[model samples]
Target: MAPNDSAQTTEEAKDLVAGRRRATRYIVPVAVAGVAAATIGLVPALAASGDPDLPKITAQELIEKMAASDTQQLSGTVKINTDLGIPSLGGLAELGGGSLAPGGERGESGSAASPDGKLLELASGSHTLRVAADGPDKQKVSILEDTAEYSVIHNSGEVWAYDSASNEAFHAKDDGSGTGPGKEREAAPKDLPTTPKELADEALKAADETTSVTVGGTAQVAGRDAYQLVIKPKQSGSTVGSIKIAVDAKNGVPLKFTLTPSSGGKAAIDAGFTKVDFSKPAASTFDFTPPKGAKVTEADELEKEKGLERGAKNHEDFKGMEDFQGLNIIGEGWTSIAKIEMPGGEGIGAPKDGEVPPEAEKFLNALGDQVDGKFGSGTVFKTRLVNALMTDDGKVYVGAVTKDALVKAANEGK
Candidate 1:
């Protein structure tokens, strides 16, 4: 074979591997995010006009109801829309042979792309999710795109993830022990704030002198009666306006969540169920078998051991980090800020000596404004809903408020 041809083949192989990894990263979070949203009964629909005659409830009463909400067998379809205002990386789909393209998994390689392709689909537009829960431990979530579908089924201690586009599947068995490959099998980070109830709980925990909670009113979502709970940050520097959650009137489950920035024209992130059914999904829904000729990866005992070791090391490393010591919350509730002292070039994938990679610097410059302050030179990345400030001095401040809030937090050094 010609040398040039060999080089091209090698490059192509690298791209394929990278594409697979990207797809896994993108698809898993989305599916798990769907489950988190679904677990809280966050099915989306346009909020119905307010009902003045509905019984008005206090904020404390609403919190109690949410705490006591029933979560059992249920199924629903959710719609997720996110507009982060980040420019799309041009030709990402083409570079990966349309593997990241939305709708109909057809790619230049004549194969269905992985569910990660749906990331491109959701980045700019809307997507549909179907979720069902049999109990706390049994659940299924499926993401349906125009031409591709990704489904995860967990039942009877077995978990299976199938991608229709790639004709591939992954299987893992939970041996009732929480420590193993089954532990690493989770696609989404357990710490992500995905659900309305979870988000509300976090906010409530942070609510202090700087925040307030109020009952926003009553409305209907997905044909079910719901009461609106609103959380607002009192700090003037906060860029956040308020967060609103629609709680199911009957069960106290949250049906929808919306985050609106203080200077906001629109909700930056809107996720919820578009439709829902209280009826339990059939048992067959969780049943899955790998299709003929599909690639399969199973998590055996050895693999489980390796996963356990990696998790242990990761946990230990996190605990051993001292750079973040003395970190404190700057504000409370929706606009709260958290600042951490980072060692120069020590963050994940960070370049040495506090140097920013050219590509990343360019991207950050485009997305935010550069500034110098007592904390050091840094860039403040701002979006409709969140803001982050990273300094060359190895400090990081982030908040769901606005750029000003992040800046304030950065200036008030620990």
Candidate 2:
């Protein structure tokens, strides 16, 4: 259940998680798609174990090794396979991605990859494959064929991704760098934190009470000696069911990662590295100067549409309709219009004395909060207790934003 906006319940935190979900499906996909930024070229980094013959180590130890690496510049692709996977409800999983296919609403892939967690740096030459096992959400592995084009760079406190195709560079934070070229891109801060260990600690804390294990093997990835590590969660929990991250044993750079579920499903990510250049990037790589007339807008600002926000936020107002009656609420526009209808009911605006029942009190209370005491005013027009709810959440009760659209849909339904 979504929390009320009054800051009482942890609903706002849920909203934040919801927002991250959208960003993943939208921003990450666009950044990782098909665009390579020039100016910056460095081979992906990996740690050189003091002793090559050392036995398998913990995931946290591996991350610590990553933190000490100085390599930069690499390129590759990855595919993730899984068997059982649950729909992402909280965090960035809610980006509305039913599947990784065309026409499906896309989300950012990086939401799953935070350098602050089990990672030090995600570079161009790095390839990661995630595999899962279980439900329909994890039936097959998604092969991210060629992903060098969407190279997101992070140094110190700055994050920048360059797309050569569009000649546009995006910054993770608001650094005022337009979506253009010639502007100076920020440098990797000297005191930047690269704590994969810290991130791993958080992961263990946030994770369910279960012990996870890792084993090691070898495989050839992009013609390199890659080390394979398998991580199996002891319990059947929703987070990090099972994961496999393969890193180049020679260079210690990650080659691929696979995440799977315990129920038996699949999701895979396979990254193939093409080149690893450790040379310093050109001076122009850090700049983000937009073109003369290229329009630029913040992603958050663009999502603030009145209609869509109203629809999503009020959706909770429409649940539990086993005994809801039918009455017409004041709809905007159109005279004598019946905006909504149910299987066994009529549409007359407002409650007809005893129309509303006590069971619906909670639902109506939610709506009243949105109305902000505007009910009973002429502006609110009419109130109704419909037999059918508009959404799965008992909120969003079911009234047309405009009388015209409501009539159109009702007629079309008939």
Candidate 2 Cα deviation (angstroms), residue 293: 5.8
Residue 397 CA error for candidate 1 (Å)? 2.1
Over 1-414, each residue of candidate 1 has an lDDT whose tens digit, in order, gives: 466798888988899999999889998889999999886664332234545356878787788788656567789998877766644432446554433443233423222323344456566546688999876567888889669888877886787778887786767786753344335534343656445566557657667467788998887777788888987877776766778998888888788887776787877667787787877788888888889998765646424544564577768777757655646677665667777665544563223343777786676577768787666677777766567787765667877766656766777763
Question: How big is the positional error of residue 152 in model 2, measured in Å on the Cα after superposition?
Answer: 6.7
* Alpha-carbon TM-score of each model against the true structure: 0.66, 0.35
Worst 10 residues of 2 by lDDT: 132-141
Q: What is candidate 2's lDDT per residue for 1-414, written digit by digit as tens? A: 545556645676788898999788887666655343321222232322322444566666665455444445433334322222122222222243322321122233222222121121222123343222121111111223254243344333345444433333444453443332113322332344435566556655544344454546665555565566666655322223456766666556666666543333444223444333334444334434444543333333323442364465456545524345454553222112333434344332333336688566444544432222212211122222111223211122243123223323333433
Clashes of 2: 100
